[model samples]
Target chain A: MLDRDEDILKAAESWAEVDKGVALATVIETWGSAPRPAGSNLVVNEDGTFLGSVSGGCVEGAVVTEALDVISSGAPRMLEFGVADETAWTVGLSCGGRIRVFVEKVV
Target chain B: MKLATLSAINTERAARRPVIVVTDIGNGEQRLVRAADIARDPLHIELERHLRMGKSSVIEVEGRELFLNVYAPTAKLVIIGAVHISQALAPLARSLGYDVTVVDPRSAFASPERFPDVRLIAEWPDVALPPLNIDHYTAFVAVTHDPKIDDPALLHALERDCFYIGALGSRNTHGQRAVRLRAEGVSEASIERIHAPIGLEIGAISPSEIAVAIMAEITAQLRLPKASTA
Candidate 1:
């Protein structure tokens, strides 16, 4: 229950050091029965290899896709997903909770 | 985040020290705060509170939104006895994601047959504790109720500055323990820190209930504000 590991963050650093584009997506906020807590991270490399979870599996694919864009542009973006959002059907949290993720590239 | 900042955080985590990354979500600016540097940081109050809670939180200051992502070491439980209480306490702690270790000098008590899938050290506290590296993240419990075993283990725990130090004993038993510890050069303040009547005042009569009480007290010690004790 309490096995929180920072291995993903470590992987993010090592990938960036090897000159690979790395993007980190963190759950900055959560509301009403979120699967993951705020500050949960998902690290994505240039090849879309990802570690960790911001919204369990419900929104990781979407976050990884956005992370690739952030890695290329070096611009951070905030993505929100939930039943209440317009993109909910596409990448909404199936757990019925809303989460705001902050996606940023490692420089 | 900068590569240097990320590397610094990984370094601190490798050493098992608490660190926080304060991020400015508005502009994506971020800075790393090591445990040793938190007291001097501009947001020391917020950072210390979040670290004590072992949680990450978002706060607003000066019209800016900041997310504090705390990376604290996993809490460890060092049980100095392999008795009934330890048997119950070990599994409970493990379920809570704590690194639980039971140390008893007696082979019969520390047998793997009795306590399965747990780290059982059949060695004296002096030999067992040093290598365990008990620190502020550890909760040390002396439940052997034997002065020969519990006293030295508690002394080592005190020296290590464990976040929680508890012993399974009544007020009368603890009074005598205090005298013995004082004679051995432990200060009055340090002795006072030990929870003599260990666990919450829940009138726990069974080993399982006592384990729950102890875990509850540890949870309070970990998550509650340092100033709030009752």
Candidate 2:
């Protein structure tokens, strides 16, 4: 629950210290029974490591897995998570919620 | 960069200028000072106030007049109910950047065991509220319809000018409460400040849905211009 600007700056500061490229993911929208609200944040490092979350353990593993791709590619990407997704079966939540996450690298 | 921005915001807030502190990520350990004037700076400045609320306020560069309004991120929501609605509300408000505290007089309901990571106040409002210092930035909601509990808290909230005062009740119940307040000589304007029917007209039935509607209304009110909206 950090604010949008604060989370980005924190990621940048931490990345600067470790000399790792930082990628940020934000939940811009959500559907029924979503665990986190819009504006939820997650920060990822080049090593495929991350801090914070965009879902309640339901979609984070996928997000982190994709975030690593965003960091390596250095390109902003948008991801979707929900019951309709074929990979949704992998995570535990079955409550039928959808979330849209926007990922970008902070320079 | 941080010190200068903090100083700028401090001066503005001390001079009664409205400013907002923007912080990022979880745990709220990082922040930047943001204002109409300060936002023009090249480097982002994170402004953080002591959580102690109302103590020493320091702005450096002695003897210069700067009009600044330092807003403390988002105001807090203090709820006096532990029902299912609160279960949805605590996390929602936290996401919206409000420091949320849920209080229930019943020890069975108020325990931290039930509400993980949420600040729970087991004491009654009269006892618990003073330390919290409910102010203009604070919004209070009393979901428990019990007069013994909600009434005393309502009185305290009205007296303290807590910004948004609300209670969960029907039109009939709120009407009766209004009558009681009038009999006690509380002004009509003051009684009107309470969002009696509570949430917006979303026809919410479930507790979580009700929570969403209430939060949406509060958020809308918080964003509106004070004089125009009132």
Candidate 3:
């Protein structure tokens, strides 16, 4: 249950309470053979430690890098990844799916 | 996505109360909705629908894309017996993500060896169930057959408004149980909710099959919408 959505949110809250720069990434839309459903959360701290998944490790590394930038910038970002998209070249979803993730700092 | 909002959502979840975090994905504007306040919200019907299904989805409202992230408590299964059927039922329910607990007052019947990794409580229902906070999210089953154990547990389950309350018995036995419960002052409406002769009509003949049947029924109750007059 530690990896469940509830626990992931709990980690976000605890990380933020301790003054750590925390960012939350959530899958807001998906199509084709998407691995995770909408509302799947990925919580990341300033140290790049993350819990949960949005694309089942297919795009988590890229999302974490973007999340770190979001944490520092304090600005939200909307990210889109599809098998046919330009950004898919480096971190392609092997499942051949499309997912839109919203990343925001947990201020 | 404020920290205060995140903390509040966690508090409601820890209390086993359903909560929703509505995020307007267009701008990252967010709002938290508690269970008691769902009715007054503008999107009450859609909110209740997702909450009941324990699902999260994106919906468009007035051209704004909102993600309704429903945070429902983990569903629990309280088995009032550690009988043969429960041995199978506990593991099956756990596989479906239910926090399964087996209760029986008989020490010999409620042993750790029989129910591995399950929350085994070798105490009477009156002693064991209250602390579990059997809420609307819980699915309660009384499979002990002994009136002394099953009856009280069932009464408590009804009182707590458990989404599913089932008792393992034949129709004939259910008839007798009806009389006993009526005598104990349980209203007719409450008694009608119990799925006596528990489980789906799967024509199950074995203990494992019966467990499957019961779990199937529970899944429907948790996920499917009720027949609506509206």
Candidate 4:
């Protein structure tokens, strides 16, 4: 009965158990025309491998980049992206919506 | 956040008990709260509200953002007949993420070939329902068209807190069914909960269309607020 989110967390745990640095990103909030809903999760491994999604490919690359940093520094980071922001065009979230993703290293 | 906490959460989820994972985003501190422990938790009120709706949310508590990930057991659809509608409804419900179980005492109707990949119980309503563990997350549909079978199934569904109880029949047939239920001493409020005719008024003719209407009505009941008829 493990749902998709639980499976993502389990995957993160397994990755960490094998000495692969793992970071978990979760969608805390979304506004306007966001593709994914809140509470969606994405887990990243140290080798740049990942599972699940936060924004349905809208800002996953940016989140994964931040996740690698979180995995290295062991510090959590909250990322915001939207068409209203200047970074949105670069991050590819220009789909006309805002989303807040929290990335943390799984310890 | 400890790995043991995640393991505990998965254990509770496997057991089909509702659980909420409360995580502090600032410090990465996480705790697993079982449904029974919600009453003792500091965020009991918010946890209860989210649990009832079976949704997850992120809330700010005293300037610290905490994500409440609510994990309830998968909803179930207990159909009490193996008719054509059940054939369509089983896969439809499964596609909609419901754990479906088709119950009928007739072994020929509840055959494995008919309900492949679906759970089938060839037992009478009185014998099968109690073990099915029907709860508030369950949607019960009695479409047997036999009073002896459908009546007991409806009674069991009413006694439990099933979110939806639908019975298949025409208006006149339902009227007669109601009189019989009243004679059996079912409460007026409980009787009112039964959705006779079993589906939305979409003028559905085929079995699949009727299944669509039934699923739509059940979704409406599960997601929408009750309207005032007055």
Best-fitting candidate, measured by TM-score?
Answer: 1
| Candidate 1: clashing pairs of residues | none
Candidate 1 residue lDDT tens string, B54-103 = 78878999999999999888889999999999999999999988999999
Error of 3 at B223 (Å): 2.1
Global lDDT for candidate 1?
0.91
lDDT of 3 by residue, A1-107 (tens): 52378889898998898999999998888989999988789999999999999999999999999999999999899999988988897898989999999999999
What's the distance in Å from true for residue B28, model 3? 1.7
Ranking by TM-score: 1, 3, 4, 2
TM-score of each: 0.96, 0.53, 0.94, 0.75
Model 4, position B221, has a per-residue lDDT of 82
lDDT per residue for candidate 4 within A44-82, as digits (tens), equals 999999889988887888888899999999988999999
Which pairs of residues have clashing backbones in candidate 3? none
lDDT of 2 by residue, B1-230 (tens): 13334344445544434454333222112244344445564332322222213111222223431111234444789998777788888888888778899887888888776678889998888888788878767878988777777877888888876768888899999999888878877888889889988888799998888888889778767765455556
In TM-score terms, candidate 2 sits at 0.53
Docking class of 2: incorrect
- Clash totals, every prediction: 0, 19, 0, 0
DockQ class, candidate 1? medium
lDDT of 1 by residue, A1-107 (tens): 22345788899999999999999898888899999888788999999899899887998888999999999999999999999878888878877999999999999
lDDT agreement of model 2 with the native: 0.67
